[model samples]
Target: MTTTSVGAPKPTRHTADSEGPRRSVRRRSLGDLRVALIFVAPALLGFVLFYLVPTIRGIYLSFTDYSILGNPIWVGVKNYVKIFQDKLFWNAMGVTLEYVLLNIAFQTVIAVGLALLMYHVAKSTLIRGILLMPYLVANVIVALLWFWMLDYQIGIVNQVLQWMGMPRVAFFGNEFWAIPTVAFVNVWRHMGYTALLIFAGLQAIPGHLYEVANLDGASRWQTFWKITMPLLRPVLLLVMVVTITGSFQIFDTVAVTTQGGPINASRVIQYYIYERAFSQQDFGYGSALSVILFVILAVVAFLQMKFLRGNENDLD
Candidate 1:
C-alpha cells in the first residue's frame, strides 16, 4: 500500500465555522448601520438646510451692513457697538430679564404645586388630561383668546372684576402692568405643560422608595424634602432651562397683546429683534441682537448644566 501521510493536514472544521459566522455577523452589522443612516438622512438634511445654515449665515451677517436691497459691506463690530450704545436695546434687555424672572418664578411654583396635587389625587389620569388641555391649544389661538379676555373694555376679565365690585383694570394700556400681564398669559399657556412634565417625573419615582420612607416613619413633607426633591432635581433643572429660554424669547404674545406699546414696556428682546429685522429693515442690527440673545442663553444654560452636574456627581 502506498504510504499516504495519515497526518496530512485535515481541513480545520472549527476554523471554517468560526470565520464564516464572524464575517456574516460583521456584514450584517454594517448593513444595519447603513439602514439606520439612510433612515436618518432626511432629518439631517432638513436640519442643515433649515436651521444650521441660517444660523451660520445670521452670525456672518451680524458683522456686515446687509439689508434687503444692498450688498453686504464688511462693518466689523459696528452693529454690535451700535447695540451697546442704543438705549432701546438696554431697555429691551431689562424688560426681557423681568419677563424671564417673573415667568420662571410663577410658572415653576404653580407647575410644581399642581404636580404635587396631581401626585396625591385619586384620579390622576383625569386631572392630568384636564390640565393638558391648555397645552394642546395653539399658541396663536391662546394669544388671540387672551387678547380678547384681557381687553381693557368689554373683556371677560374686566367684566368679572366689575361684577365682583372691583376696578376694571387696564392691563395692556399701562406700562407697569403690560409686562406682567403678558407674562401671566404666558404662564397660563405653559403652566399645564410644565406641570404635566413634573407629574411624569413624579410618577417615575419607584413606589418602593416611598414605601421604605413611610416604614421609616417619614411624613409626606419629610419624604418630599429628603427623597422626592433630591430625586427630582434633574427634571427641575430642565424645567428651569426651558422656562428661562422660552420666557426670554417671548414674542407672539407680546406682539398680539401689547405690540411693544405703552412706551415699549412689553418689548422683550425677540420683539426688538423682529422690529429691527423686519419692521425697520435693519438686518445687521437684528442679527447682532440675535447673536447677543444666543450668547446670553448659552451662558445661562452652560452655568445651569455645570451646577446641576456638580450636584449630581456629589449625589452619585
Candidate 2:
C-alpha cells in the first residue's frame, strides 16, 4: 500500500466524483437565483413603490390632523375616537355589510352554476369569452349602461314593465331597492370571472376519480356533492375571500350611478372614506378610515385562510 500522512486521509474517487456534480449543481442554482431575481425585480419594485409606500404613508397620515391645507399635526387616537362616535360611519358600515352579504350570496351561487354549466355543457372558449365580455367592460360604462336601462321613467326595463301592466320600480331612487340594485349590478359584472376561476379549479380535478364514481353508480348530484364539492373547497374559499374583499370596496358603481344617494342607502364604507378625504378635504380622517379598512381586510383574510383552510389541497 502507498504510504500516507499519519493524520491526513487520501481522497476517494467517489468523493471526487460527487464533489464535481455538487459544485456544478451549486453554480447552476446560483445562476437560476440570479435569473429569478432579475425577472422579479420589476414586480418587486412596483410593489414597493405603489403598494408598500402608500400603505406606510397612509398609516402615518392616519395619526395626524391633516386637512390638505396645512402640515399634518399628530393627534394620536382622536380620529379613531371620532369614527367610533360618528353616526354616518356606522350607517356606512351597516350598508357595506348588507351590500357584501347580498353580493356574495348571489354571486357565489350564480358563478358556481355558470361554472358547472361551462364544464359540463359548453366547454367552448368562444362561450367563455362571451361570458367574460361584461367583466372586460369599464365599471363606469357598465354602471351608466345599467343606470339608463333601469331608469324609473325612461328606462327600457320600465317600458317593459309598463307594457306588461306592472308598476315601475325606482331602482336607484328608492331606498329599499337602492342597495339591492347596486349589489345585483356588481354581482352581474363579477359572476363570469368568478365562474372562470372555479372552472380552472374544476379542470385540475382528476378524470379517473369521476370515472370511479361512475363505476360505483353515483349520480351527477352525488358525484358533485362527494367528489366535486369536497375537492373544490379550497378554490371556493379562495374565491370567497377575494370576492368579499372586493365587495367591501364598492365605490365606482355607486359613484357612477347613485353617488351614495337615497339618503346614504348606497354609501359604502369606501365612498364614505372618499367623502371624508377628497370631498371634505379631511385627508387625515380618510387615511384613518383607510388604515381601518386595511386592518379589517387583513383580519378577514387571515381568519378565512385559517378556519376555512383556503390553501390546503385535498388532491395531495
Candidate 3:
C-alpha cells in the first residue's frame, strides 16, 4: 500500500490573476462614483437650498393666512376660494391666456420665418450677426428704446403715421393698442433669440437631405414644408412652449410700459401675484396664485413633451 500523501491542489495562478483584476475594477468603479458625487455635491446643495426648499415652503404658505408681518395661520383653502371668486383674478387669467396665445402665434411665425431666411443666408456672416444683435440688448434698454419710439406725442411711430397721412394713434395709451403694443415689443425683444434657436436646429439637419430633395426637382417651398419644417419640429415645439410660459409670466413690459393700465388690460397672472404679495401684503394669496401658475406651467410642459416625443420618434 503505497499511500502517498496527496498534496493539496495548488491554487490556480490564472484564477488568482483574474480575482486581482476583478477586485481592481470594483475599486476603480467605487472611486469613480465617489469622485462624481463630490463633483455633484455643490449643485445638489444649491438646488435643494434655493429651489426645493422655497417651493415646499411656498406650497405650505399657500394654504395659510399669512401676511408679510405675521406668522402663517392655517386657513384651509380660503385663499384658493377667494382667488376663484375674485373678478380681477378671472380677468387676469383671461388676459394672460390672450397674451399667451398671441405671443406663441406671432413669435413662432416670425421666428420660424427668420430662421428659414437665416438658413438660406448661411454664407452671409454679417447678416446673421445683424439678425442676432437685438437678442443681445438688455431687456430694460430695449423697453426704454421702444418707450421712446412709441411715446404718444413725441414717438417716432406716431410721427411715421402722420407722415404716411394716417391718424397719429396712441400705441401704449389706448386700451385696444396697449396689449398689442406690449406684445409687439415682447416679440421684437425675443424673436431673435427664438430664431437663433431654430436656426441651430436647421443647421444640425444634414445638407444631403436638401441635396436629395433638389435632385428630385422639389421646389424651395415644397422642400421647406416637407423637410425643414418636419425636421425642425422639435425646436419649434420647444420655442412655442417657452414663449407660452413667458407670455403667461408677462410683467416687465407691462410694468414699464402699461403698468397693467388702461383699466388693467395687461394685468397677467404674474402682475396679479406681485400686487397680492407686495402691494397688498397678502403673502398667502400670492403664494396660492403662484401655485396655480406652477400647476398650469407643469401641465403645459408635460403636454408639450408628450406631443414632441411622438414627433421625435417619427424623425428617428
lDDT of 3 by residue, 58-90 (tens): 999999988879899999999999999999999
Best by lDDT: 2
- Clash list (residue pairs), candidate 1: none
* lDDT of every predicted structure (CA atoms): 0.84, 0.89, 0.82
Residue runs of model 1 more than 4 Å from their true location after superposition? 1-33, 122-124, 310-316
Clashes of 2: 0
Question: 1 or 3, which is superior by lDDT?
Answer: 1
Candidate 1 residues 1-316, lDDT tens each?
A: 0121222112233344566666665566556555655676687678779978989999999998878678888899999999999999999999999999899999999998989888897355777788888888988889889889888897999999999999988898898999898888889989989998888878878899999999999998999999888788888888888788778899998888788988889888999999999998889889999999999999998898897862462134
How far off is residue 57 in model 3, in Å?
Answer: 1.1
Q: Estimate each model's TM-score.
A: 0.87, 0.89, 0.88
Please report how far candidate 2 places residue 257 from its true position, in Å: 1.1
Determine which window of 10 residues in candidate 3 has minimal summed lDDT.
1-10
TM-score for candidate 2: 0.89
Q: Which residue runs of candidate 2 sit more than 4 Å off their true CA positions?
A: 1-36
Compute the lDDT of residue 308 as modeled in candidate 3.
Answer: 72
